[model samples]
Target chain A: MPHRPALTPLVESLPATVPFVGPEAQERSRGRPFRARIGANENGFGPSPRVAAAIAEAAPESWKYCDPENHDLRAALAAQLGVGMENIVVDGGIDILLGVTVRQYVEPGAAVVTSLGAYPTFNYHVAGFGGRLVTVPYDGGDRESLDGLVDAVKREGAPLVYLSNPDNPMGTWWEADDVVRFIDALPETTMLVLDEAYGETAPASALPPLDVTRPNVLRMRTFSKAYALAGLRCGYAIGERETIRAFEKVRNHFGMSRLAQVAALAALHDQAHLADIVTRVAACRDRIAGIAAENGLVALPSATNFVAIDCGGDGDFALKAMEALVADGIFVRKPMAPGLDRCIRVSVGPEAEIALFAEALPPALAAARGG
Target chain B: MPHRPALTPLVESLPATVPFVGPEAQERSRGRPFRARIGANENGFGPSPRVAAAIAEAAPESWKYCDPENHDLRAALAAQLGVGMENIVVDGGIDILLGVTVRQYVEPGAAVVTSLGAYPTFNYHVAGFGGRLVTVPYDGGDRESLDGLVDAVKREGAPLVYLSNPDNPMGTWWEADDVVRFIDALPETTMLVLDEAYGETAPASALPPLDVTRPNVLRMRTFSKAYALAGLRCGYAIGERETIRAFEKVRNHFGMSRLAQVAALAALHDQAHLADIVTRVAACRDRIAGIAAENGLVALPSATNFVAIDCGGDGDFALKAMEALVADGIFVRKPMAPGLDRCIRVSVGPEAEIALFAEALPPALAAARGG
Candidate 1:
């Protein structure tokens, strides 16, 4: 065999598996498009029209590289969050930021903590950096166990911990006071990466006020959710100035797209559109719950743009239902972790797509039951 | 001071410095925009109109995340490059791919080699990953020294080496046969990151045929140059199948902006526009050379989108001229390295911007001469 350069042992040991297989890949393999594209928890209602207009306007100026400082978008976020611009570091998305954060904090064989079935992308980053992941199972209520995470951090002396409020896979959440209590309980040296990607869709009470005084907490927010600019790939982390400054040491500063900045700024400016989206998302949740009830399933209370419906059976049953729905061209997803796997997750979209999901559910349920 | 989480020792050791300060940062500091935006080697002729149309058409679909696999874009690239789809890995840009490559190949303190004044972003990544960089000086002709780089790689036993053909900041190139010889001379254990971001603007004879059989060589190309989609943040790497597969082990799969894929695919389909841009860039390079001659400066032969004009003095003199040009609203930059710093680099742009540069050059040169 010809000699070849060897990958660092850490990277070589990593499994070449993606965290999520996107619906587009499914479409390619299936040889047909999903009639309802709602599997990825994307804001299928789409970005504000103003954002589209801004993107169209900026398209002609696509030659310019993005501002490395991300000054304008960070300034806008600072104003909106009532924090200093230095407290924010905007990047491609929460996904890319997670990798950066991991690189900053994780050394080889270092421990990192997260919920068992939390965002797989975060787990991917931890593994990519060779961090030993110590997972805490979700509580009986399907919420991330704050006490468990604190205990794991103390036990492993983990440098980083991840928590996604208004959680993924299972849409349960903790109110601000409880979250604050959890924060107070963590070891001071343990950094908490509080992902609030779904923040805009959740109730205000579920979010704690910005606390830039704490050096260990980094709260990440994105335009991808209720802002409906997922494709724009813009996200920001709010933290103490020095904590945010650490990003500058390792970030690909010019990695952001110029149009991402323009689209995010326009989306942020349209508060009226955001409010409308939130309202529509709440209504869609109820509609999905109603559809679940019609199918003899239970829908979990959700503070996010997506609803997780318990299929009144087991993980295998939910998987069967999800596959049936996918086969019928109604794109939907299910949680795969043991306890959470009984549920199928569906994101809220425009009425037309949701109506398609509603129409496809009964047959999908029948197929799952082999009736 | 309150207790806080600490950055890893490696990250703490790294300084918080950006690889290159963007022109936008300068504009913000100066409280005005430049008349000629040609400093960063961005293709100011802009992307194909077809790409803009594609972006506008796809703007409403901004809610969807990019296809994590980058299937369609990679397929197109593979078809164009005469390689299997598995031989390609697409990411945010060449900047990001550099970081990923460094992370994959360089262990902490591993030696990495590059031309002394070559791409700083690659150096930034090496430092960020705790790799010790070994620099090789350019030859007397001001081209990257292939023999010197080979010597440095052998001397340092460097795991990774970076080469940007039709190089940046100097805009000089070596012919294809020489590049192939350089590649052949390297030990197979040392990976060569061949950055061909300027490849599209160079003569076909300047680029070697794609040879995906070599696991030690990764050839990176981007839409940021000739295709003029820098704002889209789309670039790809071509390598042997297993080598390319290694990227999937660590990359942020969904980090690419959805519209970026649309824009790049559309840009690739418009070869006629790319050909037109290449022709225009050549003419503009000649125009810049003519302007430099009129100003009593020597314009270096360039095979890229930018030309470097020697100010016929030392580094300090070139710095003064570049500053004067910047003050006059002509955004030009100069090399800061020892031998290379005697020149100011200017990118090709529309006639209006070039005219602005032309008008500003005489006063800038006079200012440099203490007029």
Candidate 2:
């Protein structure tokens, strides 16, 4: 190949990879849409009617650029969260926030700690910023090993650490007090990104109170899960006043679409709709667990919108089962990392989707077992 | 004061600032909306009716995430531009692309080059990434000094350079051949970001053909300009496949909202609407120039939706004039950097809005002069 313009030495050395692909790509590849849209943990229950109405109403007004300050939404969020306006900074989602936080802290070659198979998007940003990853294996309970992460952070002297509570894939969570202890133990020099993207569906016991007094922790929450606003892409971070203000340094000023702000603001005000979705998600998880028990398998306890069920075999068996489900037009995903790979991840959805999963799992497992 | 968490050295060292206070925020502070909203260079004509209809249709589907690959839009763009899909990367807008490009090339402490009073957002990104900025003053002429920029890049061994053709703030453009020479003259180790955001409005002779085969030059285009989709925030970069593919290493996979994709695709197909808007914009630009002449001021020739009128005084006089116009409920802005500060920027709008500007300028000028 002829010589070409080079990426910065750091970017050039990085791998060419993506953390995840949306289910739309999979459907396109399949040349057909799935019968059950319960994959990727998107709110198949959908956003509230009010949210959709707000979107439609605001569609024409989109000719004007979104206010870069995001004043109205931020003020609304402050009022709702009982925090001051300066305590919050909103963006497209926590994904963008993670990228920003990494830039704010990790210099190239700086150490950063995360779980072994935690949120891959976070890892992507860490590597993109040339931060070295110091990943700890999940605790045997399939929860992020907070103590191990703290140890690694101190050992590596990492400037940034990431954890997703009520975790994804496995859906296990650390309790509030354990989380508080973990926060207290961390060095002030290391910033903790507590991504509670699934916070809405999680039990109150799993969530610590949002206190802006702590400068070391940035709490990230999203409307993508229970609010059914995944397509809207609105998320925000809460931190001490100065830390929250720091996001303004590098955020794309006009990045958020005007309609997204409207959709998110409307969603926040519809607590009844959120409560309904959370109840539906919880019931769906229980129904999925019961279905797993009927099949003589085990479903992991979950605090999120998904359930991970063990196939009572190996990763290979789970892989075949997942593939069989896809072939049966029941879209679902499985963890590819070693220990986590024994389970197939199924998202909690409406009865129609959960029923489809129940109908397909038996035949899919038979195919996986070649019975 | 309590010691809350500290920002990273780079972030703390940066100022708490925004490039511009949004017009909406200004209106809120002033307790009323602007009568003629022609300040932010937005297309007052708005998006195509078809695009608005498409957004309305897609609003309900906001429950699902947009395709992370942006496959359909990329395929259509590739077919339109005679480039392969592998040669294109789409993002929120040119501002986001500039920031990502800066991150891809400039390491902390490395030099990057741009015109002193050019796009402040690009400079914001450079600082966000800790790249030391090396600014070249515009030549005595209003246009950016291309020769001076090239000289500075070579002298500083800067890894990245930015040049907005039909440049923002001034609205001047260079012909395709001159731009081609600029690309060819850059070092193989350096990257050039050619922002052709206003390409739809500029004369065809001014734009180089899309050249995705060039590894170092990435031409950024947007739907925000003549396409009239600013609020949607869709933009793309065209470059060699090798360079373009690297964006996969570090982008918010699910960041592009579903509405943005459908709206852009619809706008792209409605070329007649775009052409109509361009004609309307040109006519308005000429009218604006005439209005400026009537007021005994000079209107810099504009190939953009906005024109800068030389106030024939210092920066303070121009600023005072802009403030007075705002007081008259006509939203307008002025360039703030030293050499460019003597001009007030006004966006082209409908006839009524133009008349509003015509009626407001002389009185505002008189008031400003008296003050």
Candidate 3:
């Protein structure tokens, strides 16, 4: 073999695979754009007019680097959450936050626990850091199984656990009381990463209130969902002061973009616009469920901006249906793990795009059945 | 002790220090904003007007996630750099890239080498990843000691080394032939991270040609400097195909901001604007040098967007002068490492900001000397 620099043994063992194939990649391969971009759970309704205005206003200031401390945005988030400024650490996105969190807590060969099919990006980070992932299956109702996770954490004495409220792919969630019970059950040595990316669209009862006193839990939120700023790449982790401070040890201090801070602060200030987006997202989710019923498939109950429709077949059948939708210029996704793989996941978008998904579903279902 | 989640021993051992304190933090502590913001090496001349328009035009698209592949930008970069598309990987910034590179090549207790005080962020990453950093001091002429780096890499059997041309702090550079000789002298097993972030602002003869066939070299450049898009957080690394492919194993695939992509693409397409900014930057460097001479201080020859003005005294005196400048509402910084600490670094900015620095210099010097 030719001489070259050697990658660490752990990095060498990892595969070069992306957690999610972006819609643009599909569009490129298909040689055409998706008529309805409802995949990836992106908010097609867009950000507030105020945020657009903020971007335009801040465009000329692109020469200056961002405030490395992220003081102003973190202060806004703190005031809104009724938490101390020390409780939050902001970064580029939840994905980057997850990676940094893994680096902070997971040692090489340490066992990390999560649901089998939940948030591949977190799993990617765990593997990137050489952590051994122990996955528990979802419960009968398609929610991430709190009991199973607690059992695995105890069984393996795992140091890190990941749970997404109003979970991705399945769009199922546990109520606050049950979630609190789960948190209380975990050993103090185990850290729980509670991802609330979809919290704004979920029921009020579904989210636990901010509890920054706990040293073992970190709740992550983002502007990517109901705030309608997915492309801006801003997210924050709320935890105990010490836990938050640990992030400063490893985070790229200057990584946050200046416009992200500007746009997020503007987004937070425009609560009315966020309220408006939540309303539209709820209506669109209902519309998607209605389309599923009209096509004779059952849509799972969703507390998120996306709904999963049972395809009344198997994982392969669901994949076929998703591929058919893609071929029809409608972008939709599906859960790939066993037991949850019998459904197609569709995100909430504007009425026109949802209408396109509505028009195409029956035919796509037929094509899947034919295959 | 109260029970809590445990950070890895390595993280526990790391200090919670920022590589550089942002000017905003200083302003907040000082209770006033600086009259001139020339400390951080930002291009106050601003990005191309086309980039501003592009940002405004793409604001609504912030609802969509950035294409994780970063395909369009990579293709454009590939074309411009005269390399194949596979040779490039784009990310948020070079800081994030440095962190990822260390994660890939440096294992716990493994040796990494760089010039002392060259770039503290790179050093921060080395420590963050548990690598043992071996420093080579700059040569007597104030350029990074290439001969010293080669000897250290050979002696330590280091897996990674960093070199920045038109270096920060001292703003000193080596000609292309000298850099090429340094590259040729390194062992193939040693990876050299050639940071050419100042490439656009330097003389054409200062940058070596792109060589994608060299597996041991990864050259990084950014839109942050002469392109005047520091706030956008767009940077790319060019390397041999397999070497570039390694980044995919650990990078946050969706971390690139959508507006950054739009603005950077627009900036790259506007070569005329880049030419205009380069001319402005060259003039500003000379203006800064002239101001230094007028104050009876010597300005080092520079090939960057910043110049180093020697205070003709000890490190403490130079630091006092910088502090006085800050107190006078002129933001400036000094190199803190021994031997490099006799000078203050000033970034090229708008003429108005430069004039503020010019006005503040003499009084600041007098205060330092009096003290």
* Best model number under lDDT: 3
Better-scoring candidate (DockQ), 1 or 3: 3
Stretches off by above 4 angstroms in model 1 are none
Q: At residue A37, what lDDT does model 3 achieve?
A: 92
lDDT of 2 at B242: 86
Candidate 2 or 3, higher DockQ? 3
DockQ for each of the predicted structures, in order? 0.85, 0.65, 0.89
lDDT tens per residue, model 1, B1-371? 43999898999999999988999999999999988999999999999999999999999999999999999999999898899999999999999999999999999989999988899999999999989999988898489999999999999999999999989879999999999999999999999999999999998999999999999999999999999999889999999999999998998899999999999999999999999999999999999999999988899999999999999999999999999999999998888888999999999999999999999999988998994
| Tens digit per residue, CA lDDT, model 2, A1-371 | 43575677888887877788777788899999999987788878888989888887887777789998888999999998899999999999889999889988887789999988888889889888888999988898488999999999899988889989989778999999999999999888789999999988889999999989888899999988888888878899999987888888777778998889999999989999999999999999999999899899999999999999988898999999999999999989988777888999999878988999999999999999993
What lDDT does candidate 1 reach at residue B338? 86
Interface RMSD of 3: 0.8
Candidate 1 docking quality: incorrect, acceptable, medium or high:
high
lDDT of 2 by residue, B15-92 (tens): 878888899899889999999999988998888889989988888778788899999999999988999999989988
Ranking by TM-score: 3, 1, 2
Where in model 3 is the C-alpha error above 4 Å?
none
Evaluated at residue B267, the lDDT of candidate 3 is 97
